[model samples]
Target: MRQRVQIEGRQLEVSNLDKVLFPEVGFTKAQVIDYYVRIAPVLLPHVAQRPVTFTRWPSGVDGQAFFEKNSARHAPEWVRSVTVPSPGSSRGRETLDMVLLSAVPDLAWSANLAALEVHVPQWQVDGAGVAQLPDLLVLDLDPGPGTGVVECAEVAHRLRDQLVADGLDPVVKTSGSKGLQVYAPIECADREHPSRYAKALAQELTRQTPEEVVWRMEKALRPGKVLVDWSQNNTAKTTVAPYSLRARPLATVSTPLRWAEVDALRGGADPESVRFRTDDVLTRVAEHGDLFDVADRTRAVLPAV
Candidate 1:
């Protein structure tokens, strides 16, 4: 059943208020909408002007799931789509017209479709309709078999030092799953492309700490080590945005972390300390504000590849 509701003075038809989307936590579809609505102020800036690939769970997460990139025909006039050349595609240069999520209402609308996960590339579409070069370099750390976020945290400390050595300020975050994502924000225009520098940095790190980290996806190389997935730096990829909810059984949110919090994990703090859920994220935003404030839109430039 569809019901009209007012969100920031915009009338939206929100349905399935009582539907349990996260059965483990008894979280409902309405709660998901509320979470997005509340987190939009911080969430929108990271996603604004960027094309988004949405993970939709129409029948709750367990029933059915699909990823959607195109804007719906019934989408509001304020909502728009942009077609861009696929990055590094070999199949005759494919193009994808992705939904440009520019407004808070867009979040609510997608939440209505049970789109719980929002993924955005590092680059954003400018007013000129050109895809700007990525200002952020992300290093994805995936733990190997028998290892978990603890190994990720240990690897993250090493990565943080290396990133700092390279003169890039590192911001850390939980991937809302089992890994950690470290992002270094830098100036993009008129500088070297981020992919070159990102790949180089990742490669250098692997060389510097072969035992602690590996860059390859080979499962054998991953055992007892954290995989520094540098491939995510490509123009086509996206890390889970901070504060976005994950469809995991615990309904965890990808959360930003202070360097101190990252260090605290070594002091016996639970990795779950940083694992935020929808409600916990709201309270956190109210109390501490966006943990990503340090890494967003940084004007610092990378020294050289």
Candidate 2:
């Protein structure tokens, strides 16, 4: 049976199929409740009006649409989405979708999500015309157990600087878990192009941070450091769908964090040490633009490789 539960006044539907998908991830409902309580404040503002869904699959939550839909609503003027064929082979598999949120609009504070839904009749997917998508692109910087938040933040700061130097605008947000996310806006292009641009940016960022960050594309080489994955930029790749409950059994989510909280974690604080409600960081961003503006200062040294 599918059950609908409310968190922070938002309603979510969870299906029994979700439990069947992950029997080993083991997390109690109480733990999942705690996780939601912790992440809601920081993540809500970025995706308040967007419709989101959670997938209880064994692999992970499907976050592409969550990001796409929300980015469309908050920053549509600058971002867009591209639809592609679903990659799964099973009969009746859901159609695969991808989006691009652009940040190149000339207008000030006008970046909103621009979306494109591809019709996959053969796959039973319906197309929605250019509409609002989400504005957040998260690079979950998961460093191993021994790596602290400071080390991760230092690397995140460096990565943001590298992206800005490449002529891309990036913002830093704490993952509210063990790592950080360096989000950049995709401006003035369709979905396909932004994915390409994001991939280029990810690759270049990893190349510049060989000591602290490891590009996950090379699995054999990523033994002990942070994984700077470019695959997420691929149209087919999916992330933790925003607002979706993670299969962490306890329902931990991919929530956002405040800069101060991020700094606290960097200083050896626990991941749960700080909690933010939705839009709290966005409010801060509104007051002080782009947390990762150092990118503007170091542009000459790190030209897009």
Candidate 3:
């Protein structure tokens, strides 16, 4: 059975099944509720009006089990599952409830699915379409386990400033996990091209912060600090499906944040540290709409590339 948990005036339904899922990842019911409250707004726009499937599992299921189920299924277009893998596993297992599934528009879906395959190989795609992916791309800056929020925000700010200097409008958002996602739109005829653009942008960020961040493409030599993943740009790479539930211990929803909050959170404030009862963040997004100024950025960067 599912019960309603209210966060910041938003209502979300949590299933009895979630009790099993939560403990496996070290989250309590209230924390789970808090996560949804904070992230739902960010995810809503990407998943708006789309049909999705929720993948669930019992608490004791191991990572291998989680991986097999997802790899074996023919999920709907809009459905993806999140997983909570066991710690210390070299090959990350697909823990249940770690991914989100959605039926994105054909163009965006095709592009995103292609991207997903590149970034995460465990996922499977069941359908195809001729739609093009969005030119707005994101380069996720993931701070490793021990890093703090201040460092994350500083890197994000620097990256954004660099984009602006380069004549692109870059926007920032919280991953609702451990890091920040910097997004910028590009002018591309199809999804394949955006990955290359995103990679170039990531290279620039890494060059600026060689001490703090390492791009994932150089995997064997990863510095074990933060990772600047350009793979999200790959036409076959997939990000947390917008609105797809994450396998966070508290089941945090990967949501978007405003620029001011992004700035504030960088200085020790928690960007993903939000509650369902807080209207402050949602109010800010309502005022700002989406973060990337696509038209301006595209015009500036496309010609140079």
Of the two candidates 1 and 2, the one with more favorable lDDT, higher being better, is: 1
Per-residue lDDT tens digits for candidate 1, residues 1-305, read: 88998776677888879999989888899889888888998898888777888888887767778876654454666667788876554255487667776778888987888889998887778996678878787888888887788788887888789778877888888999998998888775442467677677667778988887788889989888889888777777776777788888788899888888878886778877877787777887888888787545455777665
Tens-digit lDDT track for model 2 on 189-222? 3434545555665666668767666665555655
- Model 3 C-alpha lDDT versus the unseen true structure: 0.48
Candidate 1 stretches greater than 4 Å from native: 72-74, 87-94, 188-192, 294-298
What TM-score, over all chains together, does every model reach? 0.91, 0.51, 0.58
- Whichever of 1 and 3 has more lDDT, that candidate is 1
Superposed Cα RMSD, model 3: 9.2
Model 1: worst 10 consecutive residues (lDDT sum): 86-95
State in Å the error of residue 272, model 3.
Answer: 7.1
For lDDT, the strongest prediction is 1
**Model 2 error, position 18 (Å):** 15
Q: Which has the higher TM-score value, candidate number 1 or candidate number 2?
A: 1
Q: List the residue pairs that clash in candidate 1.
A: none
lDDT of 3 by residue, 1-305 (tens): 75654433434444543344445555443343343444444544453322222333334223211322233143333434433332233245544332332322221222222111111221222233222445556778777655655567777787777677767666665565677777765555554565666677667767876777777655554544567777766543346544334555554444455567667876667544542122444454567654433334454443234
Write the number of the candidate with greater lDDT, choosing between 2 and 3. 3
